[model samples]
Target: MSPFCRKVRLSLAEKRIECELVEVRYWERDPDFLRRNPAGKVPVLKMDGKLMAESSAICEWIEETCPEPALMPATPDARVEVRRLVQWFDDKFHSEVTSNLLYERVNKKLMKSGYPESRNIKAGAQKIKFHLDYMSWLLDHRRWLAGNTMTLADFAAAAHLSALDYISDVDWNRSENVRDWYAKIKSRPAFRSILADVVPGFPPPAHYADLDF
Candidate 1:
């Protein structure tokens, strides 16, 4: 699955919002898929007989409707911090790292788009070091990505990283804090389904689902 789709999936898992997983290849731009989201994104969430597009908006709606076991901070200021980090991973990290590595290596072959570009793959591999260090630094001081409590920020970052992990791109030994943080999150019930993700012709590394890793 795409990182964007995984982000929404993680939120649903965390909130215990039972939903069906319907895989859609947005690149094909199927007519029915386009109707759900004019943008033709994979993560079009349907609940209570209504359709919702966009990851950020759907996540916020989930937070509002399912308040228990909150994924957002109670204070406005803290929530502002969470949003900032969420965007940081979703936009910045996705562009620099994910597009470079995962898209180049995985999406290309899956969609028969073209041969994977070497330059983008190399760039993604190099840039992931910086992002991992950033995560390590954040974990050193805070209990989670945004703050002390687990929030949407953590799920957002994890969603992208986990996709990379599926392809065995992440260097878990880069930082103890980051690795430990991942281990903790990885063991959660919310993370179980993610570990089970399988993409045809691209088998996951053994460590992808290993909690000890």
Candidate 2:
């Protein structure tokens, strides 16, 4: 599962926007898909007859177009924090953890790429401890990742964590704060579709969709 795609889904759901979901095999580089996005990335959004690529930009466009149930803060400073945390998860956490674990363990098999590398998995397992600890620290100070209110930052972090949770890679017990935070977000109505998602070859754990979990 692509966390980037999940993040966009969360944004749309939170805004109460109705959208048709399309599954694309970006790696296959289908001509029509490439025409929409030459970069060949998943999570591309086609809205108002225009093809939109890049998850973050597409999300910002949605936020701009639909202002209700705002995912971004009103103040510039608060918005920056949201953007910063969004970047943190999408870039740093992604390179260090997701690409190492989910890509290796799941994407490899799905793409028929290769076997999972133990070293990368181990590195991802270890790095996640630090990220969880950091999340715990952040939760210690604020109600949400970027501030007291839930924003795009929460969805960004949840996107990656939810995908990893699907594969049972996240150790929720590592931090009660982080665990509690996730349980809160995971219970939202917007998360319903995410919880119900199922992959062809992999079945999620029982707790994956459990709201109390």
Best candidate, lDDT: 2
The window of 10 residues in a row where model 1 has the poorest summed lDDT is 15-24
Tens-digit per-residue lDDT, 1-213, candidate 1: 688788888889987877789888889998998999999877899898999998999999999998878999999999999999999999999999999999999999998999999999999999999999999999889999889999999999999999999999999999999998899889999999999999999999999999997
Candidate 2 residues lying further than 4 Å off, grouped into runs, are none
Q: What is the lDDT of candidate 1?
A: 0.91
The sequence of per-residue lDDT tens digits that candidate 2 reaches over residues 1-213 is 799999999999999987888888788889998998999898899888898989999999999999889999999999999999999999999999999999999999988889999999999999999999999999999999999999999999999999999999999989999999999999998998999999899999999999887
lDDT to native, each model: 0.91, 0.94
Clashes by residue pair, model 1: none
Residue-level lDDT for 169 in candidate 1: 93
Clashing pairs in 2: none
